[model samples]
Target: MADITGIPPQSIDPDQALWPNAGTIRSSNQTNAAGQAGNAEKPTANNKDGIYVKDRLEDKDVKPEKIIFSNKLEASTYLKLQQLATYGGENIQEILEAALTAYFVGKEEASRPLPPKVLAVLRKKYPFL
Candidate 1:
């Protein structure tokens, strides 16, 4: 389609096409150019450093600024999650929260004090441990 200035759409500059972050999303915080946002669910409080932080689990309804990248596996997982949410008649955000909670719970468990046997093996394998 022709734009108002009668310029036809063309491919992005070749140099930009191969740039490392070409497909990466940028947040407004990274730029001096004032940006605008639309009606996303609002976020909660901010720290003295001006970053938003949700203090309560109930604040899940409040949207926060973030970015995520996906490959085939992650994209497939999200698609399956979306399907499950549709089948269960639930919001995708709630499903996402459940998934995040499960992931973190595993992480927390993995962080607990290791058994003496495991620690001995690890320490033997890597003296820095």
Candidate 2:
């Protein structure tokens, strides 16, 4: 015959009788009281002197500045120019202007098409052209 409690036979020990007050059990009311106490100890509002508050203010102050340059190579060239200027005792602004001018001149030269001979070879290889 099966036990009316619906518990498995192996789980129940016939040698030891079950007591009503044996193991530790917590009620729902006790858990709610503990949760309320923990919540009360937690901070309700943000602290003005906190790291997050300082970072927010710093972020607002950081504005992107306008940078006028022809290309990435021009910027890189400008850095090299600055280094040369340091060694030659010239000003950074002067070096930057010279680099900018050289970049523009080189760009203009590169924009022009190849000569007729080079164009003929390219055309032979690429039918679409």
Candidate 3:
């Protein structure tokens, strides 16, 4: 499988136009009247000269949480649920609950802890003692 970078290029017909206007194609190096490229990169919220929040690190609203997965199957299922949530206009929590319900309905063993090595590492890093 190809490395995860961005969207992979799909095979399309060369004769058919990709966009709405077939003839007119916008160039990235398009210049204005002053002979300078009008396509200037705007600073994002994370950038130094950004117009948005000056210090995102100091922001109280950015409450980041970590979600630990047991296996690749669970991780893949969670990713699918996330996509489903986005497409179906449902919240992630709702999607996750629905997925978990479906998953547990047929399964006998519901609760399973992380592997010994993983648990040990996690315990060492984030000790309860």
Candidate 4:
């Protein structure tokens, strides 16, 4: 992947496009015109910027899953969501997935308990201190 294939479809100055104009890569805390400091540096497989793409951090291919949204968000809200995603260096899909997952996990943890047999086994394996 490191091997550059000629040039990209559009000319990209890595320093200008992704990095600061400084001679070397600047700190993640450095601010850009978009005002995104890229605070979180959990690297992804693609590793575009330092900010974490919660879903991509696992180094797994993002399976293309299609689902239709009701598109209920107001236009301004949608734009803000896009801007936040861009500024935070997150994939919008991953952000949504993380939100959905957290919601479901929270509900599941509260509503669903493991079978008594499993709990017993765990208790036996490691006694409560």
Between the candidate structures 3 and 4, which one is better when assessed by TM-score?
4
lDDT per model vs. reference:
0.52, 0.48, 0.49, 0.53
Which residue runs of candidate 1 sit more than 4 Å off their true CA positions?
Answer: 1-73, 106-129
| Candidates arranged by lDDT, highest first | 4, 1, 3, 2
Question: Per-residue lDDT for 1-129 in model 3, tens only?
Answer: 135766676767764444322222123233431242233334357566563452334522222343323444577877776555445645554455576789898565665667899889977865751
Q: Which residue pairs in candidate 2 have backbone atoms (N, alpha carbon, C) closer than 3 angstroms, thus clashing? A: none
TM-score computed on alpha carbons, candidate 4:
0.30
My TM-score estimates for the predictions, one after another, are 0.28, 0.21, 0.28, 0.30
Mark the regions of model 2 whose C-alpha exceeds 4 Å error after superposition: 1-82, 106-129
Q: What's the true lDDT of residue 58 in model 3? A: 53
Clashing pairs in 1: none
Best by lDDT: 4
Off by over 4 Å in 3: 1-88, 113-115, 124-129
Candidates sorted by TM-score, best first: 4, 3, 1, 2
Clashes of 2: 0
* Colliding pairs, model 4: none
List model 4 lDDT by residue over 43-129, tens digit each.
454467654464342433323343324447789977876766556665566667787778887475757777899878866755551
